[model samples]
Target: MAPAATAILRETFGFDDFRAGQAEIIEAVSRGENVLAIMPTGGGKSLCYQIPALMGEGLAVVISPLIALMRDQVCALREAGVEAGALTSANSPEETDAVLDAIGAGRLKLLYMAPERLASAAALSLLRRADVRLIAVDEAHCVSEWGHDFRPDYLRIGDLRRALDVPLAAFTATADEQTREEIVARLFQGHAPRIFLRGFDRPNIHLAFAVKNSPRRQILAFAEARRERAGIVYCATRAKTEALARALQEAGHAACHYHGGMEPDARRLVEERFAREDGLIVVATVAFGMGIDKPDIRWVAHADLSKSIESYYQEIGRAGRDGAPAETLTLFGPEDIRLRRAQIDEGLAPPERRAMDHGRLNALLGLAEAQECRRITLLGFFGESAAPCGNCDLCDAPPQLFDATTAVRKALSAALRTGERFGAGHLIDVLTGNATERLRGLGHDALPTFGVGREFSRSEWQGLFRQMMGHDLLRPDPSRHGALRMTEAARPILKGEAAITLRRDTIASIERRPVVRALVRDEDQPLFSALRAKRRALAEAASVPAYVIFPDRTLIEMAENRPADMDAMARISGVGAKKLERYGAAFLEVIAGEVAPLHPARRRLAGGEAGPIYDRLMEAQAELARGPGGTGKPLSCSHAQLARVARLGAADADMLERLLGERRAERFGAAFLEILRAGD
Candidate 1:
């Protein structure tokens, strides 16, 4: 069994070995045991079930939450020569028929469908006949209402599991202890499965956070430095997505905006474009990254603060998926923290749940202001421990800290003396002794705390207050419209018994950053561009995402190695048998500066055994262009039709005529059938 699994890993998926935890999960699932794998984003979770599916009998039913994800996985599986199909509403009639046909013929090894499909009686009936051997659920955390991305449809998965009576394997990147219990309660009905808690640390991703200083320019500068890399810039609001996208585009970046607010078609177009196009930056809200499976996203930048530590981890996890060194930058300010706090407080959750939510946000803040290693704090929040990682901003350039006990006391005193009903701006003004109409009207100018904080400048006091919020000593009261209020943690500091330290550099004062390390050298830029151009042309012509043709990592390898032939190109990672056969010659021609008029239709069939037969069929049809007697009008079948016929090996004229129709079949059916028979 091990030998067969390894062979499948190499021959079918082009991977020599399973990633760290994948082999164990695959083995357990192959042995007919249930599995719950908590792997990281790029942790090869798909293979845990994919390999098992290949090893097991009958079809492996995959329950995915998103159509794009299902489509991507199916396309990738087909590219690797596995028999996979998806039953999605996004499918065209021809696509649906093909999937149904594969199921009926027992030719499909993996069948992917949305969780919503389980709601339909007809869909459930179809699955009943599918002879499902295992049920694999992707993004399995959605089953839990406590999870950030809960879906009501995922509740149907447990019913489907019992109906199929097959071993179930669930996969997700983010599920806390509460969410995990909820998942088991709902999906597994309180039964324990083989739970594999893979570590959440994504060491390949460089985590950095900055105070939002000229945020637009900061983001633009980041984009300009990494000129043509595929990255995502997540904004807090839909309006921000559009605005930031326009800013990046105006600054001469290949950028677009995506949000849930857009029309479905428009959002899909962006998703497709992002998948296909390299060096294209997508400025999106949190709605964008959940279902994305693109592996070569070089970086992900947050223009604003993420809602929670899990969210931050998930968003940044979208980068460095290929296990290459990827970078992330999250910019946050006092305003963002206030907004996040208010959002959590304003939610309709119960008091205990809201308090837990606040604690989650505070954990994220601790990481942002961490004087030690960011990774340690972040992992620690998830109940893991790690040494200081040198990759984070705090580790690389430690912030200068100063004791702010006196300053915080002054700020806290001002808030208390002023009734704690004003916002940060008003509080700051009173602390700095500013005489204004609002202060005069409130008679807060007579307060002793006023003018006593004159030792610190207004900006300095603002930074101190921000640090107070970071320490959980102060919070913006939602009931009073973001009024500054002291928490229990502030008592000791207010009494001068406890000391607090603050970073001297305010978030807004941190200077703009230099360029990040580029993925490729300057000299290799041209070759990479040319390779991307070839990939784009092929993808556009085929109406598939460019990554489906060849991912960036593959293209980078090609650009670096400048593979001289099929054999050399075949050795590149991600250059599977099918991809090498389909794209090797075209890329080679580009690298070697040779011109090849690759017929668009023939290109689709290039690497398969049927490629030669497809060419023969095309030639036969061209010869009969004017019909049997060379007197009729020219007619031909589409390349897809010819390729299908070639692969189907239709022997008789009846089968050939059925596929090509009467007129075109009369013109070329005899010769096409002859070619198919001869090839056989």
Candidate 2:
């Protein structure tokens, strides 16, 4: 009835063979297999339907949540010589008429629209008349309210599928057993669809998560390490997004902020700049990162904790789509949990839902604290079992651990002895037996367990408390902002249901610490200022955040290496394709004496500033590079602030009290100070 699908794949799409699972799905859809494809972000999910549409007698309909994504897909389809067009709210009367005409004339092979658009009776009627052969839902997890990025309107998708009586392929990257069931219930009306999950692993992108301690400073320190790589930094609110973007710019980055409050024109400029520019860092709220086609984002960083694990996975999935190494970094503090809890408590969801959300948050926290392979923890969260992934931070550099049964019991007894009314600080004091005023007033010094924990330092007690929280033996009551409370699991630790072993207070990892570069000149203001000038020019020309153009690390590297030409510059690791082409001449001019083009052949993860940390950085980079909010996670402070705290080892409640304000130190103080001392 129409051109064979293989013909389109071979001739129109210019491909000799389909990727791993495309043909199978296409054949299933061709034979009318109702399908649910759980492919990773860059797994060629589109081809499943695109190839089938080319063979079908009628037009294939695609439902996408992002207007930008729809437009890009349509344009790409047309470029492949396929008659494809999209209908969105942005369409004018003329544009709408033209698309309808193409469909009615049977000239259009594919049509894309958002699920919200189909709610209109007019759109439904048009679908009734149009020979809609297959329905492809991109980011289809939205249909399930249980999903992290759930959209209520997406619940209407199954209705539309039934109305058209067509085979539908529901697609998403992170659907656990529960989410998969929810998707089926919503999309297939309680019937299971053929499921294909192509091992939820993106080996190219390395994943890393860091607790936010002095967010702003840590951000800079982290970015400085991989200055020339592209990345995204996410914040929670529009205000934080704006503030962070400005701060990044001042810190010598071409950073641009994006939020819904900005005029559409302004947002579009930021978007274009980010898309075209290599190594661009976009600072924005969740309003930023959906369906963006930017493929080169090498890292994703969250200044805060995400609302749910689903959001975390989806946001981070944006990186490494090009099958190259990228990093994903998230900096979270204690306040993030509070904010997320407050959001869930206030949402329309029921109490059960709220508790479920709390559990999920705890899972995320556990994942963060886990010393095992990060990928293993992540897969476990999604209801899929995975053995240790050696590529993660924990695997590459394992943490120190110790049996802390005695220590944990001392802390628990202190909490119980104090009747659980005191805070972790007061509790830790009783264990390490710090004779603070509160301890003396409470007469804890007279107790048997008091000072028994003197064998361990005060900071060790603090680390034990954090690990306990991760184990779910302790929870901070929201009303009290995490005043010590015993969860049901506490019985196990207290009564030995499980033996408590703790990670040896490994607050210090060498790689996590800042290394002062020996080769660089100190206080070389003139040269440093010149470097900033180069960064700004390159950032503006590429329309990316200044750091994306040339992170401080790259600039520092350039000043040290002083490569003479494109070739030598290329050899300076982190200077990838778009970089060498666009800003090559300007930098080469600076180093003209040694000018010569290095081989354009790509480099590997070998000896360089980028070699060791590239993969972890890429995971965080992709997570924060999603549509609006980047990672759409909660906020701490600016990256600069985090680095500052990390440099200063402000450990425990008292040191945090002295160094950081009561509010400032509590969130970041604990983590950053740990990192600082450990690095030292």
Candidate 3:
């Protein structure tokens, strides 16, 4: 609708035409209409304001909460050759003055700042002088008191917009109808806007969940199947972040730790390293990495339970930002649920906030124990109508649901027969026909319901109980470590007052490769391998990992584009200025002409730690192990020392100390003195 917007969209944003909902949103704001845009993440939310700002008659002041995201968006605009700048906490006085001067001169198109900075004299003076075209608020949901990440400053944003006397647009990835209404009341001061509620559907990511049974093993197996894949593993605390990171590395993953606990500088370094990788896994706490800009991350996993469903969805949306297939795995159990509940119950949140938090937590629990398509369940929460997405775990491999009425009656009878005094383990034994000493000692084998539940195995019964607990149909007695305690919902199932049906658990007869969500058939291998070879060759000369040369999304992009020339190759995503200059010629040659076959001496993963004793070294360990020459890493440390040091990150040194973990101490010992003295 706007010529300047059309030109910018075509050359810079790479769109041939406007998406279904964009042109209208752009036109409204350009015509001075206040607007609310509820686009999904990776949707064109930025454009709704950005296009209008560029084409409108005056400057648009964009208020944002995250300094990191502000910097990234500004950088992208600058890269597109637009006149945009950010007023941030990181800017020095001189930098701030320069930015203010540019805005006053009408030389800046978009100016981004934190809401708290509205009080600053420099920011205020600039906004007063510059003709404000549109006031754009990112994360508008933060103005809602019930929303997570609520900030007091966000409550004042409406006043700021009114004082500036500009038509405005507020955007958020989440907000139920109630939350959206509250956002309008609080953010725009009851002056509602033209609303755009795009459907919430991240169809690229496949959702899955597992109960916490050997969670560590489950995480390792998940990462193993996604070997050479970029992913995130979220931990509940900083210590857990580091522990899981070390565990993944020791198991031969390129894993690293990140959290708010780390020094800012250290966290920045880890973030920079991960941004360039195809498969670098970052194990982190929730407080860190709010808006990572990397687009190639293939999956997101939770080693612990998420606090709420909104949080869970936001986190999982990080995967498949490029619209490639990705995976999400969340493993949780009763202990996690209890711990989360205790935190909520003990927190200082207001009564209404507490009620909203409980509702969100219930939504997350429902997702984990759901029997239908995970995507459908997710969209339904956001009030969007979504048909079953056939790609998720439940849709692909449909579970067999069985009538659990008979099983429920038997379990209730057995519990009552045993005086409801025993925990789940004891109750399970009574139902599974396990004539254990405890059962016989209590003479509970004589109960009418005993042996009646033999129709289902122990696993099926446990799944039923877990889902039942999730649904609030049953309770777990906290004092007895979650012993089954029936509530009113259970009475109906047991007494035929209600009929209940539940899906049978998929009997995992084969040991599943936990992380292998999508497997590439052999027919797609040649092109994939050839594309990888090109990526590797480029990475080698640059001294970066293969993924650093081009993320998996870039390789997939290349396979999809197959551009026949250098210009087209340069236009591919992730082929920025640095890559264009460094690896352009060699890569173009591969795409244009490749006649070579595999040769005997040619090997990838030459530096892979698993291939040799030297390959076992993490990059830091490699630096520490260097002897300036050809001294093999194995000869540098005594075999006993290497074995002793493998146990470094474990809590108890006495356990697995026989393997690796104590290298520094054991190396300095007499057994390794000969090697150290020789400097080998």
Best by lDDT: 1
Across 326-439, the per-residue lDDT of candidate 2 in tens digits comes to 677776655676577668766777788788888887788777778788898887876678877765667767777777787787788887787777767888778776898878
Put down candidate 1 lDDT per residue, 1-680, tens digits, no spaces: 48888867765665555788888888899999988889999999888999988987799999998888888888888877889999988899999999999999999999998988889999999989888999999999889786678889999999988988999999999888888888888888888998999989888888888877789989998888788889999999999999999999999999999998999989888888888777899999998988799988998999999989889989999998877778899898889889999888888888988988898889898888887888999999878999988888777777788787788888889889878898878988888889899898899888887788788777777777777888788899989888989999999989978888888866237653633756567899799889889988998898777777877777877788887655456567677666765777888898886745555556545435677788788788888888768898878788889878978754788887788888887778778878888887
What would the per-residue lDDT of candidate 3 be over residues 199-279, giving only the tens digit for each residue?
778877888877777888889888888888889999888898898899999999999999877987787678767764557
- TM-score of candidate 3 against the unseen true structure: 0.75
Worst 10 residues of 2 by lDDT: 599-608
Regions more than 4 Å wrong, model 2: 1-19, 92-97, 259-269, 341-348, 383-387, 444-447, 508-680
Please, what is the whole-model Cα lDDT of each candidate in the order they appear?
A: 0.84, 0.70, 0.70
lDDT of model 2 at residue 310?
62
TM-scores of the candidates are 0.84, 0.71, 0.75
Root-mean-square deviation of every model = 10.5, 22.3, 21.2
Find the 10 residues in a row with the least total lDDT in model 1: 506-515
Off by over 4 Å in 3: 92-98, 349-356, 412-423, 429-460, 477-484, 506-555, 566-590, 593-680
